[model samples]
Target: MSESMITKQAIASGFKQLMKEKTFDKITILDITKTCGLNRQTFYYHFQDKYELLNWIFYNEVILVLTKDLSLDTWPDNLFHMLTVMKENDTFYRNAINHSFQEEFRNYLLTISEELFCSIIDHIKVNYSMPEEDQKFLSRFLSYGVVDSIVYWVKEGMVRSPLELKKHIVSIVNECKMYATKHPTTLL
Candidate 1:
């Protein structure tokens, strides 16, 4: 990466490290820049605010990993991996979600979920011709359900293991699709 990207990443890394100790809302720009050995101006040159940095962290760290090597047939695997990533970074993620980063995380989840689901659906789609809007709508609906569930899990202290959560979610998704398939709803 170039020097600019390196510095930006260093700033994000510092913020993430701070998140391990405190919530995003409690963190200040000075704390992040000081932790990373940068200055306020340097931080602003790359990010508008700590929330933007949080978005960057989620997009680069969590979303990228969630979407990496994604395949049409690997929805379950992808879900599993995402849950695993969240579980591994429980403190960081839980702190962000519980704090001011909640909205950002929701928006990010919707966007990436829609994008990935649309790609997978388009690839594996059969003769059925769901309109692009319908595909996107369905993707958003599913995204909300999944993301909200994960948020709830985090709020409830993630009582379940990642594998267990993945299994349950995959089963629920498959069952929902099966129902929707057998019922043949034109609205879908």
Candidate 2:
């Protein structure tokens, strides 16, 4: 990685460590810099604020990893990987979900989920015609439901294993696909 990327990763690492010990609202930039052996200017140079740092962490560590060679056939595995990553970093993610930056976190998930659903919908459209506007609407609709389910899962202490959650989501999607296949002319 480049020096700039290395510096940002260091900052992200420090912030994640702090998140494990303290609530997101309570951890200051000074705390992160001190933990990471960097200065405030370095953190500021890479991120606007702690919230932005949190977004960066999600984008780089979670979304970027999930989007690699993503396809309808692989989305379940990708989502499972994301949940596994979140479970591995439970403390940081739990803190993020419970904190003031919850909207940002939700928006990030929504963006990724929408993209994933759009791809699935496009694949389906190859077999069944769907208006562009309807495709966009359906993708957004599914994205919201999936994102909210994830947020609820996180808030409920993540009782289900990542595999279990992935299976549940996959079942739901499969049901939808079955319905679409059975009633091809009605979905539009």
Candidate 3:
């Protein structure tokens, strides 16, 4: 990695460590810089604020990992991996969701989910002949459901294993695919 990336990763690591011990609202740039052995100037050079650092962490750790080499065939596996990572970093994520940046986190998930679901819908439409409007509508609808489900899962302490959650989500997705294939005309 480049020096810039290394510096950013160090900052992210410090921020994540602080997140484990304190709520998002309570942690400041000084705390993060101190934890990571960096100065406030370095942290500010890479990120504007703690919230921006939190976003960088989510994008790099979760979004980048989940989206790498992703396709319809690998979507389930990618999602499962994403959930597993979140579970592994349970304290940081739970703390993030419960305190500050909840809406921003949810919005980030919603945006990615919508993009993924839109692509799925586009792929399905090659054989299903759904209207463009319907495809967009269905993708947004599914995205909201999936995002909310994930938020609920995290809020509920992620009691279920990632595999269990993945299985349930895949089952629902498969059912939706089956429905779209079987009743393409009625999917409005």
C-alpha TM-score for every candidate = 0.82, 0.91, 0.94
Top candidate, metric TM-score: 3
lDDT of 3 by residue, 1-188 (tens): 89999999988888888888999889888899999999999888999998788898888878887788978888899889999999999999899888977788788878887888888878877875788888788888888887788888999999999999989988988788788878888887
Instruction: Please say which candidate is ahead in TM-score: 1 or 3.
Output: 3
lDDT tens digits, residues 1-188, model 1?
Answer: 89999998899879889999987778999999999999999999999998788888888777777777866677678778878888888888889888777777777777877776667556534646667777777667777888788788987878899899888877766665665445534646
Residues 1-188, candidate 2: write the lDDT tens digits: 89999999999999999998999999999999999999999889999999899888988878877787888878889889999998898888888888856788788878888888888877766777877787777778788888888888888888899999989988987787677667766766
Off by over 4 Å in 1: 115-138, 186-188
lDDT of each: 0.79, 0.85, 0.86
Between which residue pairs do clashes occur in model 3? none
Which consecutive 10 residues in model 2 have the weakest lDDT in total?
179-188
- Decoy 1 TM-score against native: 0.82
Clashes of each: 0, 0, 0
Residue 85, candidate 1: C-alpha displacement in angstroms = 2.2
Pairs of colliding residues, candidate 1: none
Best by lDDT: 3
What stretches of model 2 exceed 4 Å from their correct place?
none
When 1 and 2 are scored with lDDT, the better candidate is 2
Between the candidate structures 2 and 3, which one is better when assessed by lDDT?
3
Cα lDDT, model 1, residue 7: 96
